[model samples]
Each structure stands twice: as structure tokens, then as C-alpha cells.
Target: MVHTHAGFAVAGRPTRTRRSAVALAVALLAVAALLVLSGCSSKPDVVPSADAASVDVAATVTVKDMTFTPATVTVKPGQAVTWIFDDGVVEHDVVAADGSFVSELMTQGSYTHVFTEAGTVNYSCSPHPRMVGVVVVE
Candidate 1:
């Protein structure tokens, strides 16, 4: 197809304005690439710090293979339960039924919640609802 606008651009390629426009386009593309490479465009729901992981975690739940390892855990009141995200690049979080705690969507990180009351706390991954787990506090 004989394109009129394409012909005009081609005819104007030697102009300084065209060179400037091309440079601007290249700069914008470079900025976009940096954003994606640095994960600026898709930041996680929660950004944990270096000291975020608790030392007194009683039970650890491994989030992998679309399931929580040791799906049920029994712990005493005031104990902590930690959920580690290990499903490769897939993101997951722990959300309690009673709104007690909600973790950050993460592919590799951990979230800990201390159980203060004596009861069962049920939770599931927000992205994968079928991936459920329970913390039985006695």
C-alpha cells in the first residue's frame, strides 16, 4: 500500500525536528523498560522490611504447588504462625475469615500473625480461593 503519511515522514527524516522526535521516542521507551525491570509498574501489595519476619513463629505454612503444606496447625494462644510464599513467580496472600490478618501478595516472602484468642482461624489465598488453611489455637 502507498501510504501518504509514511511518505511525508520519510521525506522529513533529515530534519532536526524529526531527529529530536526519534530521540524522544527512544528515551520514553528506555524509561518504560527501566520501570518494568525495576518492578516499579507492578509493585507488591505489601513491601516487607528486613526485620519483618518474627523470631517466635510457632508454625510455618509453606505456600507452594497451589496448596499450603501442613494445612492444619495447632498452637497455643499468643503463638505466631508464619506463611512463606514459595510458589515460584506466582503470588499469594493469607486472608483470615475473621479479618484478623491479611498478608501481602508475594511470590517470595513471609507473613506472621500471632494468635491471641483461643479459636480456629481459617484463611485462604486471595488470588487462589481454593487454597485454604486453618490455624487451630487452643
Candidate 2:
């Protein structure tokens, strides 16, 4: 027996209750991990439309030096915002906060998303959380 500071006696070996608690904790952890991974997908929440090219892009943000050149842009409804990943050998992607858009991870490619609503959408690079940008649709 192990004596506690409060003069209570504790068992020297693990009890059945302690073993059950450990098993429960491990089971909960596995469930939590599965739930988190289930939310991930190869397809983005918002897909880039091929028609996006038909309309001219209102804003062109250059992904270089690990930052969006403009950092912010304003555009009218239905206008598109294009992100050009041209940092050369450095892979980057643009992701919207509201799940409105998501770009493919690329080193030298462009991604465009049209804003059909009037609101501000904040976004950032997945790999570089420090780099952020915003788009205000009017």
C-alpha cells in the first residue's frame, strides 16, 4: 500500500478501475482521430469552375516571397480572384476561411475562384499559416 499526503492508503498495483479508465481513454482517442480524418478529402469543399476563365479575373494576387502581394482585394459580385503561384520551386496554396474556395497545392500554377456574394472572405496558405489574405466582394 502507498500512503497519501492526506493519510489515505492507495493500492500499490493498478486497480481494475484504473485499467478500465486507461482503456476508455485510448478508445476515445481513436474515435477522435477517426472523426478528424473523416473530414479531410482529396476534393475541396469548393471546386474551381472551368467557366471562371470565361470571365476576366478582377483581382490577381501573386503568391511570392511567402506572401500574397496585395494581401487584400476588393471585387464586385461574380468577379473572380486569381492567385498565381509563381514563387518557383516553393509549393503553396490558397484556402478560404468560410470553405468557399480551396486551391490545389502547387509550385507554379494559378488558381481562381469567383465570388458570387457580397462579403469578406479571409484566406491563407495551408502550409504557411502566417501568410494570410482577404477578399471583399461588393
Candidate 3:
């Protein structure tokens, strides 16, 4: 038999209480893990859907002989157009009349613009005003 300093008997009640507490904590953790796993399995996969009305269009203009080739281009709204500059002796730029689009001076490179509105836009080069182009979107 175990005895305390005051001569009272003890029966290991503290050890049994500690063991019960540990068992309860383990059971709670197991239940939480199971709940999380079940929640993840119930959801379906997510995928991005394309819009039926969306369209992709493009046009190209060339800078040659100090002029914009095919000076006028037309396309539908929400279309993208690209300007390719041919290798020329002088540098050229593409600036919009209403400040819509601007391109850096390039001897041989390409610039792309996306037309989002339906209207007519005029563009020209800073150094060479004669090098002009137009874009019509509808």
C-alpha cells in the first residue's frame, strides 16, 4: 500500500486520469482528420470555360520605302493586329492620331495592337509623317 506524509493511503488515481485524457485527445484528432478527408472528396474538378461569343482576329502592316504597306486595314471588334517593319535605311514609328496606340522606332521589328472598340483610327510616324496607316474596326 502507498502512504502519504500525513499517513493517508493513495490508490494511483492521478495516473488513471492522465491516461484517460491522453486517450480522449487521440480520439478527437482522428475524428478531425476523417472530417477533412471526407470534405475534399465531395468537390468536383474546376475548369475554365471559353466564351462562345469571343473571337480572335489579326492584321499585319509592313513599313517599307518610308511608307506603311497596305495603309488601310479593317477588322472586327475584339481583334488583334500586328505591324511588321521591314529592314529599312531610316527608323520609323507608329503613332495614333487620337493617341490610341504608339510604337517605338524600329528598323526591323513587329508591334501588335488589339482593337477593342468599333471605330476608325489613324496612325503615323513621328519622323516620317508620310508613313501613315488606318485601322477600321467594326
Model 2, position 124: C-alpha lDDT score: 86
Better of 2 and 3 by lDDT: 2
Which pairs clash in the backbone of model 2? none
Residues 1-138 of candidate 2 have per-residue lDDT tens digits of 454443333656566566788899999999999998986655455456435568768999999999998999999998898888899888888888887888878899788888999999999887787899999998
Superposed model 1: Cα runs more than 4 Å off: 1-55
| Residue-pair clashes, model 3 | 0
Q: Which ten-residue region of model 1 has the weakest summed lDDT?
A: 41-50
Tens-digit lDDT string for candidate 3 (45-114): 2122222235354677888888888899998887867777886667877877877677777788777777
Model 2 regions lying over 4 Å from their true place: 1-46, 49-52
Between candidates 2 and 3, name the one with more favorable TM-score: 2
TM-score of 3: 0.58
Clashes in each model (backbone N, CA, C under 3 Å)?
Answer: 0, 0, 0
All candidates: TM-score: 0.62, 0.66, 0.58
Local accuracy of candidate 1 as per-residue lDDT tens digits, 1-62? 32236325444444555578889999999999998777533323442322335445788899
Predicted structure with the largest TM-score when compared to the true one? 2
